[model samples]
Target: MRSRLPRLLTPLVRAALSKRVLPRVAFSGAMSAQILGNRARSITTYTEGSDLPRVRPHVWPAPSKDIMAARDFIRESAASPKNILIVPDREPDGMASGTIVSLVLQLLGKPESEIRIHFTAAGFTIFNPLERARLSRVCQKENVSHVIVLGQGARASWSLLEKSIETKALIINDQHSDRFLENTVAVSASRDPPSTTSSLLTYIVCSELHPEARETTGWLALLGIFGDLGARASLEPPYPQELKDFKKKYTSTHLRDLVTLLNASRRTPECGTRDAWEILQYTPQTNPAPTPKSIMKGEANAELRERLKDAKTRVNAEVRRCSKMPPRFSKDRKVAIIFMDSPYLVHPLVATRWSNYFDPNLTKLVLAANTGYAEGKVSFSCRAVSGRARKGDKGGPKEYETESWDINVISILREYLAKDSLLEEQARGEFTNGYKRATGGSVPLDVWMLFLEKGLEITPRKGDFPQKHALDYIQD
Candidate 1:
């Protein structure tokens, strides 16, 4: 009966794609029309038009005290002969933005030999312990004076970095820091929405740095936005209007393709930094202007594509498998819990990819877990649909936008996980409410299952979780 439901809901799914999916696209006009074209008529993609969104005017923001101080510090540090290490996370956004920052320093008359990059693998300290150790050694050997960390920062890397350089390093990140360091100058706008690390850097370079930087690095900053928030057409609260404003100024498809190439460049965790550096310097006369097609045509990119294709295939197969398994119905049949063990799977994509399956007609309290990192610890992603009816005139068990579900998700997880033992307990956002789901670290799969089973035996509760602003890292 459960398997047959897909056959029965086929028409409904089709209708939802037309009525629901089309309007929610991030942009409109020819590009949107192409992507959403004839969904109501035919499902074929529009292959002709430019996949890029139309370009709009870039809005430059006024530089704040922190950005100004950062520029002043870089300028002052470059005046002397001491080397500067630019530590970038080994990901597309970090690579692209870090490269741009490197270029900016050069334009300010900083010598290439004086500038070096220590790329963190997988963009975290925990994952790149070896890399962190190596960077510390290099900083000491090379007589490095100052360090600039770009993109989402690694909390674990900070202490090591502090000891490596004589002067405290500057961190430009959008993600929340694990804890405040005593001497380090850290810039973060986690409370603000839609501002990627790259975008913030762009604003600083264009508005405060040399005039030439505005012309050369504007596009790179735009690419950074796509690299971090590519799948999103529009973002929710705290995300600045500048993101939507910036999209109007460029071809989104081109940007999206560029992001894909950047992501592909760093696909291999071991040599991601080297790959990104080569890709960054791949350009001819002008600054790097790589097209997705051009990158894909390369032998390396071809191999990367093959790997990605294989991963996608496996992931799709798993989604199907999860879909077929019926949700565990409780004694009262009010809650649903799903546990998926996908080792070595892609990060974050699984959540967005499988979210559509949380149909309102199916279940209300949905909790799902997937294996995260190789350490046996689990990453939990959640979704909640309004199941019980309200005092409405009609429309039974309909889905409506509410913070209740996200709040509840955090509440439950906090209740289950022992605070003393749990690792990486903080949400990616304020209360993890932005994505209409709460996603964060939980205990290992066995521990989570035990908690889930226990929760099922008790009555469902709300607001059981307390909000926490600052938390530190935990071993997975």
Candidate 2:
């Protein structure tokens, strides 16, 4: 084989002659042969295709049953002749009622003359300043003969009663079942004093959500339902087929917008009632509608933010300063509660900020002022936040219970912890015994000074808290 090989093949022949080399050459040749043989087979196996159908277009489902029910309630309320009243659980409840009432009235073809609305407010003997102003404006614009008050308690002394005797009154007791309806009948049946003849009727409406009467006399029933329930989940039947589509399109968006507008108004006192009234009148088709921008840009919001900021700054500074001063812990272990007599005047934002500064760990007992009457007793908002309870427990990190006072003085002293341990102990015992006795408790002049000094130290921030003032985040 070597003698026959050409010059170029000589190396190959020599490699083959070596045992190790011959083995490698044979293995490489086998690999090359296999690769060449499989080339066609690999191509055939790799290539494949199949036909698939196109996806169908997506379709949106119909409006939910809950939405339809809400729409029907709205439409039915609009068609009624009786003046509708909208009341919510708090301040926004008033605004929601106003907006819903106005919209429904317009839908029902009633002029401003036919509908009258009022919201509750503070003051022992007179109308709340805001309520008074609203009443004055309403009286000036329309010959308002009927006023509907919503929510649980209806104070008899509010200044709205002083208006021209011609105006009739309707009180809707939202808390108790059948109470409003019964009261309405009683008021209508009772003879008005001989002096007031212009007021013709005062009516209270309640609801079983009668479908037969809904389209025709539905407004009255819806008014009662809305007034009593506020924005609670509905238990009524789903809406009819006719209204389902429209509700699907509008209900959620509208509610979100309404909530946003209300929160804006609430945070900004400068926004005032006029701005609120304008927002209520806004419609999607209107030129100057209440968009999120419009609501935030309104003057009232700006003013409120400025005031709130000032209040916060002042209060925070005072809290820091007082915290540095020696803790005036009384001789007894019982912590003295210090707070303002007018909690309403002391904004919640400021109160919360001050509370944090005073006790970052939330170990101290801080009583904030609150306004409301319960069980025929006036109470303050007493809040306690501590690591005492777990998240799911009944008495968790924060506790809110009403502390009633018999008289303003006792309330103020108790709120300030102005009384010494002995006196405070006595006051506590008296409060436990009866609300009437607690009302009579008195604070010494020195204790009153201490309370006043503590309050005076708290300063209002120059600008509102950024979180509350920003209207973009507020829902309608």
lDDT against the true structure, each candidate: 0.49, 0.32
Q: What TM-score should be assigned to candidate 2? A: 0.37
Top of the candidates by TM-score: 1
Alpha-carbon deviation at 243 in model 1, angstroms: 7.3
In angstroms, the error of model 1 at 440 is 4.4
For model 1, what is the error of residue 359's alpha carbon versus the real structure, in angstroms, after optimal superposition? 4.2
Best by lDDT: 1
Q: What's the CA error at residue 386 for candidate 1, in Å?
A: 12
Per-candidate RMSD vs. true structure?
13.7, 27.8
Error of 2 at 426 (Å): 18
Q: What is the lDDT for 232 in model 1? A: 56
Over the stretch 1-476, how does candidate 1's per-residue lDDT look in tens digits? Answer: 44674585465456546543322222212233333323332222233576644432211122256566777777776675788887776556677667677767777777777887776544234224466567677788888888777764434333644353575477676554445344666665432122345554634543356666655555566677667655553433223334455566555776676566455434332334465455554322243454444554554355555554444455556556644434454444444544444443333444444344444444444555544333445555565543333435575444433323223454544444433232214322222332323344344444443454454443222211111110112111
* Predicted structure 1: lDDT: 0.49
Estimate, for each residue in 1-476, the C-alpha lDDT of model 2 and write its tens digit: 23442664455444433411221111121222222221111111112363433332111111133224433444554554544444322334444444444544454455655555544443221123455466546645555544454332323343444444334434322211222222221121111111100010111121122332223222222222232222232322221222233234334344443443444443332323444444444432345434333444453356544443444455445444333322223223122233322222233333333333333232343333222111112232222222233234664344323221112222443544433554444334222211111121123323323332443222222121112322232234
CA shift of 314, model 1, Å = 8.5
Clashes of each: 15, 29
